[model samples]
Target: MTGPARGGADPGVAAAFRETMAAVCAPVAVMTGLEGGLPHGTTVSAFASLSMNPPMVLVALDRTSELLALVRRTRRFGLNLLGAGQAGLARRFAAKGGAAKFAGVAWEPHAGVPRIPGSAGFVGCTVAGLAHGGDHLIVLGNVVAAETTGDAPLVYHRRTFGTPAALPEVSG
Candidate 1:
């Protein structure tokens, strides 16, 4: 999808830079939510912790996404950290135009937010703040409650899904 063009960087150069950047980064999560009672989600690598004092986290959603609109209206959402085996669920939810994304996907409602079953972890949050950045909307959430199933997290890199090969050695 084309976002608003900035500066005069050659399109080819920009594309190459993006690819390189993606290669250097590791995927973290996919978030799921309901829009008008229909399941909606997207593969997002931009999820992160924003604060610990108030228990806040952030997920960046494309401004053009229908999910973003729903999030703005509903004010509640769920973050589902994908497990290594949940790649199919990620692709299914990321598909365009479908009401059956939730089909066969085990889930339960927590405070009106849909939480994915078998996810590595699930966080129920309310939209506490929003800010526009580039082509994305940074969604700041106030964590109301959370749970973990202690599963291996799915990783994405270089435009492909993967699992952690090994953990970094602890330093003394």
Candidate 2:
């Protein structure tokens, strides 16, 4: 609703906000966009379903990220929801300034975007619009194609990756 402080938010306020937000668990996903026939991607925790009727999803990316630029240019992208065992892939994509992030990674093309193999789920989307959100760009995508696997979703919580623990069985 209201914007951040005009001049600058207080350091303590920002720290408190970060600390609080860190406790909230979120799904980990790799957002991929094509760049000159090569795949460019980044790990994203700021992603969520936005609508159902038209099948829309939202992902927030750093404003200056190269992957964001590619998505802006191509107007399309892929989102791969990682499985618990895919932490290595997540770390790889999260790294910066690499020769090729896709090197040694398993992926396939989906609607011209690269989708990580073995991910819990993957979706191909066309950018509907972008919104400025502080240092990030909120990308709203219309899901054109998507698929899901049986694998458990990888989750980010307290700045770490994990999978949800199984629930205890009960008999009524």
Candidate 3:
């Protein structure tokens, strides 16, 4: 692949960056928040644990995403970690604004936030801080409540959804 036009950054730099990040495996999640009393969510692979002392987590969202705006306005959100069998759910949220995103989906309000049922886990939090990143905003959340399931987590790599690889059992 070509580097860039001359020494300056090329227009294709953004595409290159996306291509690079696609190779880095990440967990699939559906971030949910309420807007005008309606449940809104989006698929996100940019979730990560930030701090353990106060129990904080971080998620990166596109600057222009409606979900980001909703979270900013509501100051509260839920992170539903998808399980291996929930690829369809992930795709639903990832799709452009659709009425079916929440229709018939199993979710309940917890701490005033919607938590999708049957996920690997869920985290309900309040926005603790925000930072500007190139083309994305970093949202930091202070965990108010969380729960986990025994299901294996959904994974994303190379622009595809998958389940994490299992390790072989070791004899003591």
TM-score of each: 0.85, 0.91, 0.88
* Candidate 1: count of backbone clashes, pairs at least 3 residues apart or interchain: 0
Model 3 agreement with the true structure over 1-105: per-residue lDDT tens digits: 767664456749867977999999999999999876688899999989999989999999999998888899999989999999999999999987833589889
Candidate 2, TM-score vs. the true structure? Answer: 0.91
In model 3, the runs with Cα more than 4 Å from the true position are 1-15, 98-100, 169-172
Q: Which residue pairs show backbone clashes in model 3?
A: none
Look at candidate 3 and tell me the lDDT of residue 42: 93
| TM-score of structure candidate 1 | 0.85
- lDDT at 158, model 3: 97
lDDT of 1 by residue, 137-172 (tens): 999999998888878888878877888777789999
Off by over 4 Å in 1: 1-13, 167-172
Worst 10 residues of 2 by lDDT: 1-10
lDDT, each prediction: 0.80, 0.90, 0.90
Better of 2 and 3 by TM-score: 2
> Which candidate's TM-score is highest?
2
